[model samples]
Target: MAKRWTAQDVLDLARLYQPAGVLTAAAVLDVFSPLLAKPMTAEELAGRLSADPRATAILLDALTALKFLSKQDEEYSVPEDVAGLLAEQSADNVLPMVRHLANCLRRWAELPKVIQTGKCAETGLGFRGTDADRADFIGGMNTISRPVATGVIDKIRPLKFRHVVDVGGGAGTWTIALLRAVPRARATLFDLPAVIPIAGQQFAEAGLTDRVNLVGGDYYTDALPEGADLAWLGAICHQNSRRQNRDLFTRVHTALTDDGVIVIRDVIMDSSRTSPEAGALFAVNMLVATEAGGTYTFDEYREDLREAGFDEVILVHQDEFMNSLIRARKT
Candidate 1:
């Protein structure tokens, strides 16, 4: 028999945000950056962070208890492995993603009002703020998407294609991974003007600059570059309504060569739509963050593809992480 949740489980769930809050607070306070050099007592850390000593002590103890930091003789230090990923100055730092999640937490707090009004909160969801924030968000995407790139590529197997068009490809992480897997294949990455520069930098760093053609435009209004044998849309459809996706698919169809393939990487639901718990929860996230974004069933994908004049729509992969793959061909 399967284990069941008890009252204690309910309490645990209720307090689940505590650890996340602690981590977010640490990120906001820039605590990990200071600890990268050496461990410090709460007083010294407070001095470095310009925080209240007593309050800093409390937060340090919480971090130590959570294993994000270790306590040794009153000194608090981030673990060596974690320091590289959490420190703001580290090359591999994911502080931007952490900060973005911290921002998401604030938006999620408005869920009740959003449900009551059937509208998003005043803040709105699209990328807002200066160029720095846009860059950070794109970098955060790179950090989060890197780990899953291999799994997604494995499922899609783009190795056979001579050229691929990565639509709405942020930071070119997937495109880079594809190039690494298929040495002979080249790619075109399309994204917003602001994002293309970042993708160019990433491509340059990966020695993929010569192999990729970077195009910049709003995918909603602009025509995609033509003559690609494969078009990849990673985590794109969930942000649009069925009509919008159909229109986009039609555009993509026009951009591809004869018999070109289209691959979609996203959370694909069963007809019931409830079995994949993550997809269901992500639908809620879409509700809060987008005007019409939500998870779609495989049937919905097939129907949309058919309506857009594509054939052979089929699921290539499905997993609990909501990283499902669907493929279709234009003949």
Candidate 2:
């Protein structure tokens, strides 16, 4: 026997954003960080967060209902399991990524019009805003990508490579993971001019300053640094059109040695392009966030790699988290 879905379940699915909205609001208001100090009544928490007491109380109650916060004796506190991840002062804080998702909610609101017109919103999708917004976006990316980097590195198992070229490596998170796994290996992290300084700081913080070469350049325009045994492209393909990906692969081919390898980690769709529900939903996300980006199938990757002068393309690993690995080698 199994439970049956009902009309109420459909309504519940439609209202899923309610809990998400509550969490996003809390992140924006810096709610959890204050709770780390001590549990306080809604009025005290409102004063600390500069929010309306009544509204704060409602939001805090919603968070408690969602198990993000624990409420007792009219005071609210973050649960121990997630306090480090939500607190702004903690190194493992993911508030930046939560803030980024909050921003995405605005773009998602335009989905109806986008679906009707087959066009993205009027505002272009590339990083747009002040220095602070840019910083938040980059930091958010670092937070989200750190865990993915560790998983990708475990699957990549780059123990044989002496040098790695991390194309479009934001904040050097994946590069740091690779370097840590292959202790004797060094990496060249290439990213935008503005992002290179941030990656420099990350590498320095990881005590890997001497092992990394930070290069600032757009992958679309400038040539990648040469002489690397492995070139890693993590979460880069879904941001470009097929032609752009082919061009990038050609550039990577030119940048590597005769026997060098190219590894791509991204969401890989099934041949039907409908399985892996997350990748399917992420395709819609690309529709709203990028001009020509969308998830691709393994055949498309093989074609792109072969046209770029690579041979023996293979699927190295596939994970439900959308962090699939595809590897190709220059012959």
Candidate 3:
């Protein structure tokens, strides 16, 4: 005999689930950004945002309960991790990626059509839906991607590559990180032409303009610059299908100088397709958004890199998340 789940038990289980908690966390984290460098009471925060003070109080309390904020009496402050993200506009605006889901989720509702057609909805680059959405999309993406930049530097500190290319580098977080880490490093951020002006400004602001290069064009369609010692494919591969990923890598191999290496940071699944809830949910996101995009198992990627002519492929770990750092050396 087995114990049956009661209606209340089922509802409770759903209420206590991870997605509900993560969404709540992301929202709370976003609330901290505009208020960075200044602490405020709930009433003040509510006033600044044109929201209800009582509601803001409740929300701040909830965030405190989640350990993302610290509250005492009526004062509230973001946690160190939350504040770190809020301090940098270009770090990785996780808020945008989260908001990209509002209309984007509608595509999931049409998954039946997508499945039948074998095509996922194209949500276009970064921004979405409205003007405010455009701002949020860019902000959120940069905020969320800052960790990848930090993680790349942390993982590859031992390497002394002089010339690096950040494939699909968008706003240049990876290039900035590598240059800051290795004073001798000179790096290029390869992205669409629309992305250059912004990336140039970012590197300049970081005082890294001298060591940085902005090369704008689609990596798949353009010629990769030769003699680069390292390249990064951070968070970009999960946006394409298997064949597209293969093609991207083949193009990468062609761009590398002999003995060059490619460093990829992405949400890699455990080989058994278990654990790392973020990676699992990100798979759902890719399914809902990309016709070909979905996070893959490391074993799958290793094989792909090998097929693309990398002689040695190594997988590393991120300290804060289950995402894997993949480095493949061209023979």
Candidate 4:
């Protein structure tokens, strides 16, 4: 049923960026980190962050109003619940993803321009700059994927392999999940050179460092590490065009052992490309972020996989977003 919209509803929708901008700006400024230790006056926080005092006070008050922080007297502190997810000292912090969203918000603001030009939005390195932005992006992948990976891997139960290749395995989240799922199996995690160290740190932290070999190279230009019977491409397909995915599948096909299998984890759109609302929205994110990258339909994936010498393509699982699974076997 289509409900009628009112002037206030439209105004509310237009002003939705207010809270998002406040929270993202706070994340970029590390607002919650110091507050985790102790309550502080806005001026103190401003001094610590080298920010403007009045602005800091306004942001802190806004956060308090949002219940993300607690205010007592003239000081502010992060609530324990909020701190657990935003404080730098917390083990379960998701600041990386928050920072990445800040980056995305910047690009999304240029959506109208992208629509007009058929080009990606021009964005500067966010507050912490390029290296930090890249690290946060990779870390954000772990932040988002770590919780769901084990569950996603569960769908491919009875999956036994001596070795699995995790292509573009950002920060080793899926590799860790896969290795844990198959205790007797090992893995070769392949990603860009800058990302290998991050994945290495994660592998070491997971105590699976010795079980996974980290290979650093561009999948587009370099040879994939071979000798694996199974390949896992988690959350990677959406960053590529169909042509690029076919090329990537061809590489995976060559790198696999005979009769090997490949599994892809990404958003699989419906035939109309608009049913899974999240996938459609993500397509717009890709439109602003990549030259030629967006969600794909199952038929599109099947056709691409077949072109890469794979057969018996199947959608093992269907998810409204990135948890969908597609499996294919090398012929």
In terms of lDDT, the best-performing candidate is 4
Query: Candidate 1 vs candidate 3: which has greater TM-score?
Result: 1
Off by over 4 Å in 1: 1-4, 50-54, 72-74, 123-132
Count backbone overlaps in model 2: 0
Question: Model 2: per-residue lDDT, tens digit, 117-201?
Answer: 8787564342334564567777998987887777677886646899999999988888999999999999999999998888999
Model 3, position 80: C-alpha lDDT score: 68
**Can you write out model 1's per-residue Cα lDDT over 167-256, one digit (the tens) per residue?**
999999989988888899889999999898899989998998999999999889999999999999988899888999999999999999
RMSD of candidate 4 to the truth, in angstroms, is 1.0
Question: Which digits, one per residue and each the tens of the lDDT, describe model 4 over residues 53-102?
Answer: 99999999999999999999999988889999999999999999999999
What lDDT, from 0 to 1, does candidate 3 have? 0.73
Q: Ten consecutive residues with minimal summed lDDT in candidate 4?
A: 122-131
lDDT of 3 by residue, 248-303 (tens): 89999998888999988888887766447788777776777766688788888988
Report the lDDT of model 2 for residue 294.
Answer: 92
For model 2, what is the alpha-carbon lDDT of residue 60?
Answer: 92
lDDT, residue 11, model 3 = 92
For candidate 4, the TM-score is 0.98
If candidate 3 were superposed on the true structure by all CA atoms, what would the RMSD be? 5.8
